[model samples]
Target: MRTDIELDESLMREAMTLTGLKTATAVVEAALRALVEQSQRHRALDKLAGIGWQGDLGVLRDPRSSDPE
Candidate 1:
């Protein structure tokens, strides 16, 4: 499946430079990777929310026990 879609020159240039990619395919691939990473982070947060984390969830914010790891 191949088709042509117009993209803004500024955006394309920015994406290429930011990703340091030589081809449009590379830029798109990097963008997709970032998207997947972001989605995974969101899913983790959603899972924590679903578990009713409240304030002190697994001592993430608070200090550990007197054992002091």
Candidate 2:
């Protein structure tokens, strides 16, 4: 968790300014969290994209349908 790596100072400053993060550590942590969340969202969307829907919309929208489940 304490690995040190070189990063662009200007980019770091920009990230700090944009995110209102005071330190490099905060910026890095926030960036990592955003990356993880974005990856999870993309994976969820991919899974949803693979699913197929062939049901009638009118039946779902109707209030008189007997079988709601």
Candidate 3:
């Protein structure tokens, strides 16, 4: 896919340097991927937030400390 758009030169250069990407397209794609992944992670966290957890979290951290019944 090809599209024409204007991007901030300073921001683009910074992204390129940080990501070590040689082209504007690569940098843009990488940024898009990161944004999409972050959004997905946020969505998953939000869904999990609505659930009611009843178990003791401490047991998971140290199973040996918990008595086996």
Best-fitting candidate, measured by TM-score? 3
Could you tell me every candidate's TM-score relative to the true structure?
0.63, 0.74, 0.76
The numbered model that scores best in lDDT is 2
What does each candidate score in C-alpha RMSD? 4.4, 3.9, 3.0
Which residue pairs collide, candidate 1?
Answer: none
Candidate 1 lDDT, 1-69, residue by residue in tens: 465878788998999988789988777778879999999999998878856535655566556533565
TM-score of 3: 0.76
State residue 55's C-alpha deviation in candidate 3, in Å. Answer: 3.8
Candidate 3 residues 24-69, lDDT tens each?
9999899899999999999999989968978878877996976889
Instruction: Report lDDT per candidate.
Output: 0.79, 0.93, 0.93
> Which 10-residue window in model 3 sums to the lowest lDDT?
50-59
Clashing pairs in 2: none
Number of colliding residue pairs in model 2: 0
Task: Answer with 1 or 3, whichever has the higher lDDT.
Answer: 3
